[model samples]
Target: MSKKETPLFPLRKGLHTRQAHVDLPPGTFEEEHARQGFYGRTTHLYRLHPVTDWTRIEGPLRPHCYDLNPLKPSAEEAIRLSMFGSTEAGFAPICLLHNSDVALHWVAPDTMDFFYRNADGDDVYYIHAGAGKLETTFGALTYATGDYLVIPRGTTYRFLPESGDQRYLLIESFSEVTIPDRNQLGPNAIFDPAMVDTPELEPYDATPREWAVHIKREHQITKVFYPFNPLDVVGWKGDLTVWRINVKDIRPIVSARYHLPPSAHSTFIANNFVICSFLPRPFEEEEGAMRVPFFHSNIDYDEVLFYSAGHFFSRDGIGAGMMTWHPQGIHHGPHPKAIPLSRTKDRTDEVAVMVDTARPLQATPAAELMENLNYWASWK
Candidate 1:
């Protein structure tokens, strides 16, 4: 049998004819069919500047002291401001990724009352300091410093700060966020069900309040404010509601007799990547195990680590509120000094979140501006 001849332009020329018909309305044909040449085709959206150009978008908004000073009154006020306003709320400045989808919100002491639900994306709150009660449908979860709370998509909740005062690094993923996969640790090794502490549900009764919903339109760069309280749902069921889990409860599954790898402690998973916490804990093997991460290269995904508290031995310049992105390239590990120092200690006090993406992540101009651009190619 002979092969049939395929049309040169399958979608535009072969599929549809562009003949003018007298029956059509005078302006309808032009309005609808004017740009038919590019129909049914895939296009690549291109950027004019280099991907690492941090100044390509709005420059850095404002800079504030990232450190937490318990005596600072302005720090607490910033928390109150963010609770009432969006990222625009002028409390402490929020540093966002080049892509606006991900943002790090800094909230200070006595700064509670951040009640919000993600209408567009998911948000994960990493407790940087203080203790508080998270009121959710499932119940009330008491969280302290170094804890991670994930408010799933559309899950409504409120933050009730305790008397001690608090600070937090709000990580708004803007995409569905989940526990990092445990493939590296074999089956169900990391974040086992028993290790995660699901908070007890608390019941409360009060007059329902209203909330504001903002909608973004296509091609329009403004926010449309709709005055409607989403809490209208008198009741809810299923896991769609609010919940909290303590990062401490996620016990690390270490090798009994042998030295376990860093992947042994991962706890969550997402679509294309996983999130791991390099927490403070004792090593599983040998009388003394290096508490700090060793130098290594991530061939699988781009690794982005956010330092919350404690000293990061690997990197000298790193401190709380600092973010480091180690894309797939050269090796990144603790500073040469850290390896020898960590070996002496049986455990560590460090707390950090590591995000590994199997695919390359695109940064919005916002992220580039907040990033320490000098660190882009520093590993080399």
Candidate 2:
């Protein structure tokens, strides 16, 4: 696809877009923007009950702090941590980086006896390794390795993992996660919309042994029990539902002359953060073209790269299932060895998902434990 090709852009207003809705759903649509004005795209959603049935049982808001940064190891080198494996059943997802706009988690739940609903925001689950079925009010979404699952806020769902060893990178966005506008990419959208996998509307009516739904609001959890399954929605015709997109199907836009910015690989955009994919692509072939990313500072954004698959030669010791975080105000670039190595490399099979947040992100307690205390000395 040429970079100059364009797609049809039509101004849409009114009853529905792409899909239709029935019963005049009580769920009101809201648009939370990164920029205050009507510039960025909005996510369409519906709530069965606008303002009812939600009881907030609270003791005290969970105390969270990201104000301090532990000094880096002067003589230490860059290190990687494995966020794989499962913890206690109830205490699954290990919190990693978090801020007002987003909360990132690495989870490997052994079993889910109860469903969960996040009233705070929507969730994007990047399956690092796992195969499972996500039972939600909208429908059942079968997920596997490399699937990027987007579940809207207020949606109740439970993960039924089919594999004993499951790992996931879950991004809780306080705002919606939408695809970058095709217009912005011009003709660079080599990945077709058909590659995206939406639910097939297969409603689940099974009667589970334990029918309990857990609602999470304000970082607190409350459980509601039901005699029957809660995924009883027989029909829903709206653009809102669980969505999946595998990295394997995403065709990255690459340039052999001028290295493209991360935005060229933008997969999903949120309020203060944007998710991008770094899949297999040809290296810059131009005689002196910088094949790897140039050294730079995270002046305006906190950058996180979650290594997914393949060999990422740019960074030493970084392997699949590891994450590298360069907080705002820090400067980082490719390893010295990677530069010379790129000279002869014609292509790269690296697969990674990057989260670039506008707001400074703080590492959580769990994430801090897995940190390379001396990672700051790697550049030396």
Candidate 3:
């Protein structure tokens, strides 16, 4: 079918803007392009996620959890040692929701492998730890802990480690992922211009390379098909390609006069939802403000959080590697201890990625086989 003649799926409404106040020094983009050209060498790596016929793949993959104890060589180990080791590799546990549209992936440290693209659905990834290079048809995009990446349906890509040892937390959504709706703000505005911090595309070396494309079919998975790598295209000039922006670049819209609602600093779209973040800044109402996230309900969407770093004062007993899924109907917020422990003024060192979806999410059998069942009753 002709490109323009193809039917288009209606995308939910929302806006994603780069922080206007941030500036990229002259030649930064060019420098990044050059660096990628230099250091990125072509590889013949190929792998695929197991799949079954849609008719046969129906039903829930039982839910489960995993702990990366072996991977943690030391309490202070920042790099994930578990994921890369062959013994515990594919064993990366995941949580599966029966008959829903989402799956939670928890990768232990030091794991490096090909993340197969979904042929039948879109996947959004929320980084939980370490850093790496995502090589895609568009090019290489660098991702660190706390980054969120959306790989639209049918986009082929793979992961490469930026550091020798690192682990990752990945959230895979089978449905279209989007920002929350702006209507919640009552029509004027939310996501203040100052809150978003768009990272400058730091210059990198670039070089030409070739990649192999593998197509999977019922009879047998095909392999070794050569496709001209886009990285060889030498120059790129569009936004429909892979890119990276630091979470810190997303600035919070602070109110000088009144305590702003979480929705005030929120950026909304559809298919899924995301709340930008909070930084160390003065609260609108008091010189020493100890604010906590108010309890709320998402009638239509499931709420999931991937804690990246820092202390989450609002939610008690949560630390890095913890995955919280507050499905519809659950009333969840900080623990009782958190209520009395609120600080008059605080500096937060936490970073995380939060998602709320309008449609119910499903967990794959693979996911069910790897979840931490204990979390199911932790809300109390």
Candidate 4:
């Protein structure tokens, strides 16, 4: 519940089902109105048509979809910077969605020569492609695709790509990034925290040379120079180290009788935002149960989804390495074509990362340049 609770009241005013996302009235659609990211009081509005049935959504409030493939560091850019080991113009992480709580960026970095320290917030990087090793204050850890690597704020680190291939969906949270404590589901609901791969202290062998540590605060960069290698820590001990969990290790909670809400898939919680993993899972199998996502306005939070792989059941014309943003005040759910398509399906192979921000996210000019303007028409 939020600071102000909606009095413990339950009332049904319309011709609706007793349970949400279950058997629906004929020729009717469902829209979920939730509070506090679906944990608080909610209402399932049974309607004749989905709220997304709009002819034209003008103004800046319309939904956005960005194809991030073009933004990846190209071979030309990598070859140019391979000698100097500097961040190329196109090699930098492009800020796509951001606000006070969290900022999401797309990065395909080359083997970096400089170490980075985020003085602004904690970083959670979703490995979308390639493999690499990250040397941090704690130690070094090898990273592969589909990994969620959480580096605490102020941790000095540099990502050393194995080759020229490296792409990541990086999220910088303005507050502490912690695991969601599943009160009733127990601590080991989706995954055990102990299962997370942590870095082991290893001597980072490097010749004596001047190293630059780039610190970012308020989105401004400041370089701090050191005579010797900054990652020359011999020993360390702490729980607050760079750790990661891969999507393959995630065991999604599923139900065949009822379709679970997004909150049921909560993976990580932060200040004013939450991160979720939408991995492969079985769909609702009970007859008459809604097989697709119900239409809904987040009401308070802005929604962002990064498609990692597999076919996203609720949408169409979207593939891996793509992103979609649905700000508050709009009702978006499954595309019209998706409802019938899902009825013949039993399980989904989709893998995605979802971020719900309490504050709205502004698309950067870099992200706007990669926008698919016809995304709004896909719902038709």
Candidate 5:
């Protein structure tokens, strides 16, 4: 018989309730200090006040917020913003945060004269706004807002945006991005695999000409020219083809008597990171269950949330197309003003994407340029 690596044993020795996230001690807040990003061994500590109730934090670890709306790719690209998708200028995507395992980039919709193939990693493009058509090796996928388009590595593809205002948050994972195991929740709990839409075998018919495919490998682009369009896969069948799923189709898990952890909302997972979606849903209905996110320390992974739409209940001064980077070694939770409203509000209309990475992420220069200063002070 094989032995379990981590035994399931709980030794309770504290002034605690029978269940977590419900019926906390009066006038006390709950702070979960856990291991393995709320997956492994855990201890829920009941505190007198909020863990993030800080007056000041002076260091590099302060949380940050970056705006994608009206923010140009760079200073030089700002001048070319109007000229994007034109014959004169078409810029590249601005990298937001990156580490060894995965990186996030903000795609500024522009004309792509050539196809792109990432030999470095697979790309998961979250359509934040606008509509477009992706011509890939598998087929053509018509993408709109709230769609997640996952293109496998080494697949040649290019964008054909209907308008210039397309906004996308691209997650480049060095490892293969796979559907999270459903465990006991079953396969059809959050979403059904049958609902996942794959591209049709509609190849584009264009004039025969030299086409350039920019292959990115090891942070360098190697242009390869072909006499015809590279997305000419007549008919192919494989599990490793480009696929997409919209946020509307995802059904979040919620309980009236219990508040689920962020891991419960996980949509996709890589080796060292996971992507979750927060959709418009009703708050926990039970009296003792907390409707808002509880205070938790980022003990293992760094948390990055990209706000998409709706009124963000736990956050203030945040709008769509903005992202918050709450680094590790910090305690963060609901904002001061948002807490009072959580009592009255019964539902959350917000749509956001959250990525938790095992290692810390480093922001790119473009992210720094677009950051909304003094984000950490918002907690006060």
Candidate 6:
């Protein structure tokens, strides 16, 4: 991630230098990239107009905190949690876990035609279900089930789900979302660069009409009305851009002699948290080696896992869209039966996404509504 290694995502010519944005048509647009050498990496941007032609129409969103605090981990019985209510819609996503470094959300947008910009930090959207198109100023990215949409900060975009039902595990990183440095794996990226689906330049010219582009900055949502759609960039080129990758395209590293730690499956990393995808892989086949994860305490991180699909051999009764949290200082592991059951199996099809944060995470009120109160007793 240096000046020399930035050519891996060149969408066009002349965008490697500060003069990169000067080549665009002079009028009717503004250069809007991020200069984050102070923060992390710089992202160049070009927008139809200065994204500042906005009028704040509302107050900040409700504080994201919970009333009841739960901190128990599951050993055998699965602990379930939900974020979406029966009728939540639009840009309103349920905040499930939060701390100083990151905030995790469950978003199911029923009507998603409006634009949105996170003035806060980078966002990683894990699509648990549904298919749709994400139109952003950088370009258009087609997303489906198992796709993780990585959007940088300050990018204006809108999501259009083919159907009204869509489930997303959204992680708002209070810093840049970067690829994990797995130099030990090889000189290549953790996931192959060829597997990434970067958006191509597909500009849309909407007729003059009112559009609501919500801007979230400093924990507040300001509804800004614009004269036209803001995602009108005809071309963009830079190392900093939005991209998508499906879980199926990711090949997990496995060890038959020993159980691999969660870090072996690392996908993306930020300042204080790391996101990993647990895809289908072969189980440990060696004799006397533990097939299930051994009991251990999360001494330095808070772990959150969202079950995506298939049978997870380590836990029982877990379902799709369910989430489990194991905060710092808690010891958790497979059910008592999972170890013996895993010995009878040679492979697994479980697909899950994990977020481990260095800082302790606080649960939201919405997450408390679906907690399995008897989870702690299951180990008995």
Residues 62-84, candidate 4, lDDT per residue (tens digit)?
88899988875554543432221
Candidate 4 regions exceeding 4 Å error are 1-8, 73-91
Q: Record all residue pairs in model 5 with backbone atoms less than 3 Å apart, i.e. clashing.
A: none
Instruction: List model 5 lDDT by residue over 202-232, tens digit each.
Output: 8485669999887788766678999988777
Instruction: Please provide TM-scores, in order, for all candidate models, with all chains considered together.
Output: 0.60, 0.75, 0.58, 0.93, 0.92, 0.76
- Please give the distance, in angstroms, between residue 269's alpha carbon in candidate 3 and its true position after superposition: 3.3
lDDT of 4: 0.84
Cα error, candidate 3, residue 234 (Å): 3.8
Candidate 2: minimum summed lDDT over ten consecutive residues — where?
A: 71-80
lDDT of 1 by residue, 234-298 (tens): 45456454445566666666543344444555555555555678766664344333344434445
Q: Please give the lDDT score for candidate 2.
A: 0.68
| Alpha-carbon shift of residue 139 in model 3 (angstroms) | 2.4
Candidate 3 on 226-265: residue-level lDDT in tens? 3344233445465443334456655555654334444454
Off by over 4 Å in 3: 1-101, 107-117, 173-211, 214-224, 227-231, 256-268, 272-284, 287-290, 363-380
In model 5, what lDDT does residue 231 have? 75
Model 5 lDDT, residue 64, Cα: 87
Using TM-score as the measure, name the better of candidate 1 and candidate 3.
Answer: 1
**Against the true structure, candidate 1 has what lDDT?**
0.50
Q: Candidate 2: how many backbone clashes? A: 1
Q: Give each model's clash number.
A: 17, 1, 55, 0, 0, 3
Error of 6 at 272 (Å): 1.5
Colliding pairs, model 2: 27-47
